[model samples]
Target chain A: MTDRSRDGLRPSLDQPRRGFMPRFNIALVLPAQLTMMAVVIVPTLIILWLAITDWQPTQAIPWYDATPVWFWNFYDLWYDERFVNAVGRTLFVVGVCVALELGLALGLALLFLDEWPWRRVAVSIIILPMMIIPVDAANAFFMLFNERGPINHMISLVIGAPFEFSWLSHPTWAMAPIMMAEVWQWTPLMFLLVLTGLMNLPQNQVRAAIVLGASPVRIFFKVMLPLLAPVISIALLIRSIETFKIFDPVYILTRGQPGGSTETISMFMYNGAFVYFRMGYIAAAALLVLVVVISVCLVLARPMTKHS
Target chain B: MDRKLELRALRKSFGDVEAVKGIDLALNRGEFLSLLGPSGCGKSTTLSLIAGFLQPDAGEILVDGKVVNRVSPRKRRIGLVFQDYAVFSKLSVRANLSFGLEAQRVPRLERDRAVAEISEKLNLNPILAARGGELNMSEMQRVALARVLVTKPELLLLDEPMSNLDAALRAKLRGELKQIQKELEQTVLYVTHDQVEALSMSDRIAVMRDGEILQDDSTEAIYRRPAERFVAEFIGDPPINMVTCTVTAEGGVVSVSTALHRNLPLGQGEIAPGQYLLAVRPHHFQASREAAAGTVGSEIRLVENFGAEHVLHVSYGDDLVAVVVAPGFAREGERIHLALHAEQAHLFDLESGQVIALQRREAAA
Candidate 1:
C-alpha cells in the first residue's frame, strides 16, 4: 500500500491520475530477486565465464598466469582433425536420429488425432521408453546388442545355431546402433510437443477446410502440415541441440567404439578438458560449438519469425 | 444466387436425445426465410443438416428439385456465413473473398473478376489487403458475407450472422442485409434465436421448440395470429401474460372468469365448458384514458418511469403483469382500471396450452 491512500480513500485530494502506481509495498520484490540472482543466475554466468577462461580445478592456482587468457587455444582447434571428426560425427548422428524421430512422432500424432479403442494403451507404450533414466538405461541398449545378449541369442535360437555376427565392431554399423538408441530415448519428447501442437490447432480452420470440400489427404498437406511446421522446427531444434551435446548414450552404449567412430563432440570436449587437462583448447572448442548451435537455430527459426 | 431449397422429414438424433426431431420446410427462389427459436431449439442443427455437415437419419434434402443427401458440403455449392465471421485469418480480405471461387476450380480470370465485383458490392475495397482477424467486428462480418457471395452459390445460409455484433451494428447490418437480399434477389435461409432479428428482417419465420417446428408462416401471421400459446408468449417483447380461467355459458355470450374479475365477454374465441386460460399481451392490456363503459379490474402494484415511458407492474392473484405506456404518468396508491381488447386477446387450452381456433363471421358469411 502507498502512503497516498492511507485511509482507503482512493480518490486523492490533490491528484487526478490517469495511469497506475504501485498498489502494494514494493520493498518485498528486491530481496526475493536478489536471492534468485545469487542462486541461479550467478552460477550460470560463472560456468559461461569458466568456458572462456583457462581455469582448472586440479591446478594449484585457479589461474595459472596473472592474466589468464588462451589466444593459442582458439587457433589450435583448427588443427585437431579428431575433434572435427567428432563434431561431424555428432552432427550426423543427431541429424539422422532427429529426422527418424520426427517422422515417427508425426505419424503417432496424426494417428492419435481421432479417438479409437485402446488408444491410451498404445500411446502409453510409445512414450514408455523415454521415461527411464538415460545413463543406467543406455546400458540396456548395450545389453540388447551385446555379443551374447538375449537378442543375438534369440536370433541364434531362431536359426538353430549360435550365430556370430559382429554387432559393434564396424564403424558404419557402429553409428547406426547409436542413432537407433538416441531415437528410442527421445522420440517421445517430439511426440509430446507435436501432440500438444496438433491438439491446440484451431479447430475452426479444420472445420472450414471440411466445408470447403478438401479431401483428407489434401487437408493434411495444405493445412495440417504447413501449420505443423512450427512444431516440427521447434522439435527439431530442441532435440537436435539436446542430441548434439549427447554424451551419455554414446559413452555407455558404444564407448566410442570402432576407433572413435561414435564419439560426439561433447564427449571429446569432456576428454580434452578433464582427462587430458587441456583447458585452453576445450574452452575454445566449447565457444565455437555455442556459435555453431546459435547459427543453426537462427537458420531454422527464420520462417516462424514475424517480420513486423 | 437463387435456388429452391426443401427439407423433407429430416430428423437427427444424438444418442437418445433428438436435436432435430423432424424438420420440413420449403424455401422458394429469391425469398428470405428466418428460422427463429430460443437456445437449445435445434435451429442450428437444422441449418447444419441442410449444410450437409450432419447426415439425416431419414429423409431427403432437395436443392433445385434434386435430392442431394449424399453430396458433400463442398460439392453442394451452398454459401454459409457463420456467426463468428469465419474468414481465414491468414488470408487478406481479397484472398478470403476468392477462397470459395478457387475451391470450385473457377478459372483464374473468372475468379479474380468475381472477387473484384464482390469486394465492391460488400464495400470492402479499402480493406482488401487487411487480414480478416484484424478487422473490427462489423468489417469482419462484411468480409464474411463477401467471401460467401463471391462464389455465386445456389443458396445462402447465414447462421446468426449478427448475434456477435453490438446492438447498433446489428440494426445497421439488418437493414443493409435486407436491402442487399432484395437487390440481388438471393435466396437466403437465416437462423437466429432473437425475435427482434426475425420480426425486423425476415419475410417468413419458422418458430421452433424442442426439436419440432411449432409454427411456420409469414411474419405478420405468426405474430398477429400466433398459432400456439408458446408462439404468442415467445414472439413478443417481455412476453405475453397468461392467466387460467373458466368460461361459463350465458345468454348467447360465454362469460370468461378470473380471480380478479368475472364475466367479461370476449367474442373472438369460442368458450368451451372445459378449463381454459386468457392470454393478454402487455400492449393490449392498457390503463384506460377515462373510465368510459366496460373494463377489467386490476390494481396497480408499482409504476416505473423511464424518461420516455412508464411501466405499470400490477398483481392479480399472484399473477404479476406489466403494462408499458408513454411518459407523463403517475399513479401510486391511486386506483387504476385496466381493459383488454377482446379481439387482441387469445384463449388457450389449460391442459395443453394450445391456442383455441376462433371462427370468423366474415368467413362464415
Candidate 2:
C-alpha cells in the first residue's frame, strides 16, 4: 500500500497573475493605520500646538492666526495654585483609593478561596458593582449619602440620636464620598485578577509547605504572597492609572463645589476648558497629567514585568 | 516494636467513589517501602493520608506509635516531596531550604549549618543562590530532596519524584536517591507505577489495585513469588505469560494439562483437580529446535531483539507465548519446541486468582 491523498491540489485552467506582496500587505493595513492617525495622532498634535499658543475661544481669529506665546500657558499653569492643588489632590486620592481597593480586593479574593455555600453566587454578586455604569453608580451614591438617606438614618440609629451630616456639601467630607465611589466601582476588577492569579499558583508548593511543618500563616506569607507579587503589582498599576484620572464620580457628587477641596486634575481640566474657557491652559495641564501617569505606570510595571 | 508510621483500616471516599478502601500499612524504621500500582490505584492517596493532607473517612494514622488522625499536616512531622518537584519559584534555593527551618524557629546559625551540610551532600552548593525556577530539572530535584531532608521529619513520602525525567537522568537519579536514603537511614514510603523503580530501589514492595493492597512483602518475594495473578502480570517488563490449564490428581500426585500439551506432571502440589491458570515469566521458558520428549511444538511468529537478549513470540494453537532468550537464539518463522521450568512456573486458582501451593523437587534430588 502507498500513501494516497484525496484532497490533492488541482491544476487550474486559468492562472491569475502574480501581484506585489508588500504593496498588498500595505493596502490591507492602510484603513486601520489611517483611522488611528486621524483619531489619535492629529488631535494630539493639534493639542500640542494649542498648548504653546495664547489662543482664546472668545476671539474670532483662526487658531493659526493667534500669536504663539511659547511657554506662556505652561508658565501660567506653573504658578496656578488651583492647578497645583488639583495635582496634589489627585495624587492623594489615587494613593488612598488604590491602596484601599488592593487591600480589600486581596482580602475578598482570599475569602473566596474557601469552599462555602453559594460561593459562585456571591462572586457574581460581588462583581456587579464593576459592571454598573459609573455615572449611575455616582448618582446612587449621591442619593445614599444625603442627609435624610438610609446611611444617616442608620448612623442615627447607631448613635441613639437623629444624626444628619452634609456628605457632599462639606469640603473635607466631599472627597471621602468620591473616593468611596471610586473604590467601589473598581475593587471588583482587582479581586477578579488577584483571584485568578491565586488560582493559577503552583498548588504543589503549598502542599509541600504544609507537609514540611509550616503553619498556615507561614505558608501564606512565604509561599503564596511571594508568588502573587507579580499579579498584585499589575492590579495596583492598572488601578492607580484609572484612579489618577478619576472624574465621573467627582463630577456627579460634588462638581468640585463648596470649596475646591475634592477637585481632581481631571475635574480641574474639565472646569478649566469648558467652564473657565482656558483651553490652552487646560491643554498644558492635561499634557502634564498624561506624562505623570505614564511615568508612574512605568515605575510600577517594572517589577511586574520582571517577575513574569 | 514501634514502627515509624502505621495506618489502621484507613478508608477515604470521595462522594460515591472510594479512593482508598480500608488499607492497613506499617513501615519499619529506616526501611524503604514502595507502594507500586497503576494510576488511580490509591497509592498516592495513601501517602496523602499518612502525610495528614487528607483525613481518612474511618481509621487512625499513627506516627511513632501515636494516633495522629486529628493532627494537622503541619504538626504531623512528616515530609512529602511532590511529583512536580514543588520548589518555590520566587525564592532562591537557599531560601527554599531554610523556609521550614525558619518556620520551626531554628536559630540562624544552626539553620545555616544544616543548609550548608545538606547542600554539600546533594551537590547543590553551586546553585544555592540561584532561583528555584532557573535551575534545570535535575538540579531542581536535588534541591527539592535536600530541602525535605534538611528538615529531618520522622517519615518521608515521595510521590513519583522521578516521573518527569528523561530515561538516562531517571536511572542516574534513582541510584543517587537510593544512596542518599541509605546514608541518611530515612524511613521512606515511595509511590510509583514503574515496576523497575520499585524492584530496584525498595526493600519491600506493596502491590495495589483498585484501592486495595494485593501483596506486601520483600521485593524479591513480590517478584519471584507473586501472591496473585495481578501481581504476577504487573511486576515484570513484557510481563508474565499465562495459559489456561486443568489440574488433575492421580495417585496423590498433581499434574496439569493444557490445549497444546496433556498429562504434564507438575512435580507435586496440594491442588484439587479443576480449572487453573498457569503463569510463567518470559525468561523462564526454554526454546530449542530439537524436539524433547515433554516439549510443546510451536512456531516462532516474531523476534524482538534487545541488545543482549531477544524475545521470541511463538504460536501454539491459537495462543501466542513469549520466550526470552539470549541473542542468536532463533529466527522468525522457525519451528521450535518450548519447555517450562517446573520450578519457575506458578499455578493460580482460576476462580479467585490466588496463588496455590506448589511443591517442587529439591535440586539435590
Candidate 3:
C-alpha cells in the first residue's frame, strides 16, 4: 500500500509547528531579567550617582546644593590618612582571612571528603559556628578565647603559666581575631563546595591511577587537585567577595581599635557616615571601595579560567 | 608459562541474598569463556569476585594457583571492562591508556611507548588527545579497552562489554573482539545476558540462572545436546519446540507416538519406555506444498512472514508447538503436517529432565 506522509504518518505540511516557542518561554525570561535589574543594576546606578554628588542623608555638602559635587568628596578623601589606613587594613584583613580560610577550607574539605568515622559529626560541628545566633554572637564565642576564659586557663594548666595575648589590644594581633572569626564563619561554605566537587569526581580515574600504581600522594596531587580546580575557584570567588564586605565581627570585637588595625573599608564607611556623620565623604569612599573591590575580584577571578 | 586460574566453590552473599551460589570454574591459559545468563543471575558478581572488587563469602580465588582472596582489585591485575565501558572522563584517551601505567610508576618513556602501541592497535591514535566525553560510545569503549589492555594483566574480565552497543554495532564489535582475543591469546571471562553474543563469541558458555550455573558446554554442544530444558530453550532464538509424546522402543528402533496414530522413529540416544517430550528445533522440519508422507502432527496456525523469517504454530493433542519456516515461505492459517526427523529429535525424562536410555524403552515395549 502507498501512503502519503512524512516518514510514516503525518504529511510534511500537516506536521505540528515546532519553531514557534511557547509564550511561557519569554514570560519566564522577562521577569528574571527585570528582577536582576531591580535588585542589582538599580542599586549600582544610585551608588554611582551618590559617588559624584555631595549627597548625604543628614545634610548636603556646603555650596553644592546637591546637584553634583564633581569629585570634591573624592578630593577630600585623597587627603584623608584614615581613609588610606582603612584601605591598607581592608587589604590586610582580606589577605589574611582569604589565605587562612582557603588553607583551612581545603583541609576541612579533604577531611569531609574522606570516609572517616567522625566525618558526619565534624561536618555538623563545623556548620554550627556559622548557624548559631548571628555574627555579633560570634563575640560571645570569641569571649571564650580570652585571657581570663577557659582557653587561657587550659593554656596555663598545660604550660604551667597563664598565657597573655591580647588580640583585641594589639594592632597586628587584632587582625588575627577578625581573621579567626571570618574563618570560623565561612570555612564550612568552602568545605561544602569543595566536598561536592570532590564527590562528583570520576572514581574510575582514581581507581585506574591506583591500579597503574600511582601512590596516594601522587594521585591526590596530580589527579584529584587538578580536577577539583573548578570548585576551588568558585569557593575563592564567594569567600573573597564576602571577606571584602566584612563588618559584623570587626564592629563588635575591635571597632576599628588600636589605631585602625581592624578598620575594613566597609567599617571605615560605617564610621564615616554613622559615627563621624560625614555621609558625603563616606558616600564617596563607598564608591571608591566598590571600584577597588570589583577590580580586585576580577583579578582574583583570573586564575579560575582553567575551570570552565 | 601458561597458568590456570581457578575459582574454587566461589560463593558470595550480600546481606540476605546470595548473589553467587557455590560456583566452581577454572580458566586455562588463553581460553575465552562466556558467562551467559539473565539479569540478576550473578554473572556480574562472579566477574567482580574475579576482579577482587567484591569479597566472596566462602571461597578461594586462585590466580596462577595462588590464592588472592585478600588482594584488592588494584593488586589483582585482572583488567575489567564494565558494561558502560567506564573510562576516566577527565583524562584524554592517551592519558586514559597511560593512567594505569602512571599508577604503576612506569617510566615516562616506557609509558609513552605503551600508550603509542595500544593507541595504534585500537586505532585511537588520532583521538589520543580527545577527552572521554568528547568521544562517541564506541570510541570511548576502545579507550576503555586500551586502558585495561595496557596493564597486560593475566586475566581480562569483560562484564557485558557489548550490551550497550546497537544490534549492527554489536555484531561488528563481537567479530572484532573475537579476532582480538584470538590474536592476543589473553584469558578472558566475558559476561553477557545476550544468547547471540554468548553463542558467537565464547569458546564455552556457562548458562546461569538464580545464582547458579545451569549448564556449561561448548557453544555447538549446548545447541545440539543441551543438558537440561533450560539449556535447550535458552540456546535457541525461537526456542526448542516441546510437545508431549508416548515414547516406545522395540528391537532397538525407538518409536514416538504423536497426535497422529503413526509411531515415529526416535533418535539414537537411549530412552526409557514412558511418556516424554519430543523436542525439535524450528528449522528441523521440511515444508511440503501438498500432503507429504511421513508427516505426523496437525497444523493449528501459520504466519505469512516475520521480518525475514516465517513461523507456524502447530498443535498435537494437548501440545502446542512452533516451526520456523524460511523467508517467503508459507501462508497464514495454512494446514500442514510438521514431520520430525527422529534421528535428530530429543526425548527427555518427564520428571528429572534427563535423557532416557532407548534400550530400556525397547525392552519395555
- TM-score (chain A only) for the predictions, listed in order: 0.80, 0.91, 0.81
Candidate 3 Cα errors over 4 Å, as ranges: A1-45, A57-67, A75-122, A289-308, B1-3, B244-262, B267-278, B297-322, B347-365
Per-candidate DockQ values are: 0.34, 0.75, 0.39
Q: Which lDDT tens digits does candidate 3 get at residues B119-166?
A: 888889899888876788888778888888888988888888787778
lDDT of 1 by residue, B38-110 (tens): 8898998888898888899988899998998999886887778887876666667877777667766789999
Ranking by TM-score: 2, 3, 1
Q: Write the per-residue lDDT of candidate 2 for residues B95-191, one digit (tens) a residue.
A: 9999889888999999999999999999998898999889888888888888999999898899999998899999998999999999999999999
Off by over 4 Å in 2: A1-34, A62-66, A147-164, B259-261, B270-274, B363-365
Please give, for residues A1-308, the per-residue lDDT of candidate 2 as tens digits: 12223233543334433578568988999999999999999989988988887776877778777678889888888899999999999999988999999889989998998779999999999999999999999999998898798889999999999999989999788888899998999999999999999898998999888877888788888899999998889889888988888999999999988778889998998898889877777888888888888899999999866764
In candidate 3, clashing pairs total: 13
State residue B146's C-alpha deviation in candidate 2, in Å.
1.3
**Shift in Å, residue B324, candidate 2:** 1.9
Over 4 Å off in model 1, which ranges? A1-69, A88-100, A135-173, A221-237, A257-261, A291-308, B1-3, B65-67, B250-255, B259-262, B268-271, B296-311, B314-318, B329-336, B361-365
TM-score of 3: 0.84
lDDT for each candidate structure: 0.79, 0.88, 0.78
Candidate 2: which pairs clash? Answer: none
